[model samples]
Target: MLGNLFRAETSTLQDPSDELWDALCGPQSAAGKVVTADTAMRVAAVYACVRILSETVAALPFNLYQKTAKNNREVASKHPLQMLLHDLPNEEMTSMDFRTQLMAALQLRGNAFSEVERDRAGRVHGVWPINPDKVWVGRSEKTKRLSFEIHDGDMRTLTPQRMWRVAGLSTNGIIGLSPISQAREGIGLSLALEEHGARLFSNGAKPGGVLQVEGKLSDPAYARLRKSWSDRHQGGANAHRVAILEEGTKWNQIGMSSEDAQFLESRKYQRSEIASMFGVPPHMIADLEKATFSNIEHQSIQFVVYSLLPWLKRIEQSIFRDLLSPVERREYYAKHSVEGLLRGDSKSRSEFYKNLFNSGAISINDMRRLENMNSIDGGDQHWLQLAMAPITQSREPSSSGSSND
Candidate 1:
C-alpha cells in the first residue's frame, strides 16, 4: 500500500547518489553501531520515546481553518486537502493511523516522506506515506533541486514538488539528521547489556562460574561429564536446584556481581540518555527513578513545549508548503489542536473553561466543542464579568469625612 502511494506518475528516472544510498542502507551510528530505523526501534528506550512522541502528535486533532477578514477570527472550513487529511490520508489508513505512522517514521529516521496524489486539476486528492527506509533524498548537481528516489521492489524517481517531506534537525538542509544515528553508541551499548543480562538469567541466573572435578578423567569422560552437567542444570528452570557434589568436585563463582558491575544502574542511565537524545522526558519513557509528583506535571508540559513542538511545526509547515494550493494558502492553514493534551485534570479543565467562559474569551459553544459535548441552543453568546462601576463615581471617602456624597 505504501509502495503504491509513492509511485511516480512520470517514467523519468534518476539513480540515487552512491553516497546517499550507502549512508541510508548501512548507516553507522556515533557508537560505531549499525543503526537502521528497524534496529533502533529494538532499543526499549528508543521505542518508548518514539511511541510517546508519535502517538502524542497523532492524537492531536488537525484541522483546516480560514481567516475571516473582519475580526480575523479563525473559522473551521473545508478544503480539497481535507478530503485526504481529515478522512483518509490514503486508501489503506485513516487519518490518525496515517499521522501516527508518518510521525513514527519522522521520530526514528529524522525524516518522513510522502507522495501527494493529485487529480486532473492538479489539486491534492490523497497523501500516501512512503517508508523512509525505502526513500532517499538528493539534490541535483546542475539544477540543485531536491529529488526523492523511492526503492520499493523497483526504484523510481519522484518529482520533488509531488513529495511531502518533513525534515528534522539537520546540518545539511536536504536531509534530516537522525537522533538514532547520533545516540546509537549509547543505545547500542544499553541494548547489548540488556541482552547479556537476559542471557545470564536464562543460563542459570548466574554469571560465569567454574566447575572443578576432583579427579582428572579421560578426554571422553570429561566431555561426557561436562555435557551431562549442563543438560541437567544450566538454565533458569534449574536455578537454585541442589547440586549433589561427588568426591573431588567443587564449584567456584567468577565474574563481578550485577551490583558491582553497575549493571542495573547502567541500564537506567542509558534509558535516560536515550530519552534525552530524543527530547523526551525520562519519566515519560518510564524512567521514573527521579520523578516526583510536582515535577511530573511540569515534565508533561515540557514534553509538549520542548519535545513535540518542533516536530509538529515541521509537519504543519510541510502541509502548508506541499499540500495547499496557491489560493488555499492565502486564506487556509493547517494546525494541530493540542489543547486536549495540554489540558489538566477535570478540576483544572473545569476551572479553565469557567474562566474563559466568564471572561467572554470563548463562548459556551466553543467550550462545548472543546469538551466534545453538544452545543446548547444560544450557547454562542459571549458573557463578561458581572461586576462593573463608573470611573467617575468615587468610592474613596472625601476629606470632609462624609459617608455619602
Candidate 2:
C-alpha cells in the first residue's frame, strides 16, 4: 500500500533564499528581541544542549501499530504513515535527518512545522518541513480556527489540518511562546559573556591598564605610541610577551582586579541558567561544576524524563492527530521506543530481567528480546519462583509426607 509513496525520488525543493532566511530570522517577536539560530548556536552550552536533545530523539526508533479486537496486543505494520514517518518524510532527506532538524527547530525557536503532501486520492504521501521562522499562526476571522501562513517570496495560507505543528507552551494555543523571546535577558547575558571572554583573550589575555608616562606627549605621539604597543602586544599570540617601557614609564593596572572579576564564575552561572530554561541538567551540557558520578547518572535519567519526554510526547501526539486517517486513528498510533534510553547498566538490567523472569512476570524470550539477543529453544516458557508456592498449596498436606519446617 505504501510502495508508491516510499519509492526513491529526488526532491525539487530549493534551499531557502537569503531574503527569505532574513525575513524569518528576525524582527517579529513582541519583546523586540531578535535571536537567530546562528547566534543561539554560538553559545557552547546552548549548542551542546540542543545537540544532546535532538541527537537522542533522532536516534530512537519509532513504530506504527494497529490494535485488533481479537488480539490482546497492538500489531506493528508497514503502513504509508510509517513509511513517511520512519523511512522518508521526503525524497531529499532521511528520517533521522528530518527529525533532527525538526527537533533543533523546536528546541531553539519553541516551534516546528511540516507540510503534508497528499496524492489525488487525498491520501498523505509525504511530509515537507517548513522553516518555523517563516511560518506564523493566526486565527481565521470567519472560521475562528487556527491557520498557518507561510511567507516564501509569496504568502500562502494553510489550514490547521494540513500542517503539523509542535509548539512549546502557549497561552492562546494558536501560536507558541518563544523561549528565546521570553528569556531574552538570559540569552543576551550569555552571549555578552562569551563576547567579553573572546575580546579579553584576544587582547594579550590581560586586563586593560594605563601606561603612566613621565611627561605628557602630543596627541599624534600618544596615538603612535598606542598603535605601536597594540600592534606589538595585542591578541592571544602576543600573550605573556615582555613589554618594553620607555624611561620613567610604568604600567598601572586600572581595570577590575582579577580576584574580583569572577569571570569564570559568571559564565558558569549563565550556563546553568540557560540549561535550566531548557529543562536540561547542567551536567548534560558539560557544566560539571557540581557533577559527580552518581549525580551524573541521575541527571542523565532526569534529562530524558524531564527534558526529552515532553518533546517526544508532543511529536507522538502530533503525528497521531495529523497523520492518521479517521479509520486508522481508531486502531493505529505512533510511538517512539524510549527503552534504549531507559535501560540501565548491564548488571542492573541483568538483575531486573532475572527478577521478572523468576516471578513469571516476563518470559525468557521477552528478556532475550529486550537485550537484542536471539531467543533460544524453549525460551518462550515462563518461570516462577519455586520457593514461593501458592498460599493454599502451602497450607495443604504434602503428598510425600514432607514435614513443614
Q: Give the candidate number with the greatest TM-score.
A: 1
- Candidate 1 global lDDT: 0.78
Per-model CA lDDT versus the true structure: 0.78, 0.77
Q: TM-score of every model?
A: 0.86, 0.85
Q: Among these predicted structures, which one has the highest lDDT? A: 1
lDDT, candidate 1, at 3: 28
CA RMSD per model (angstroms): 5.2, 8.2
Model 2 lDDT per residue over 25-79, tens place = 6533333335566677888888988888888898888877777778644535557
Q: What digit string (tens of lDDT, one per residue) describes model 1 on residues 213-264? A: 8667889988987887788788899888787776677889898888888888
Candidate 2 lDDT (Cα, whole model)?
0.77
Candidate 1: list runs displaced more than 4 Å: 1-34, 71-77, 214-216, 390-392, 395-405
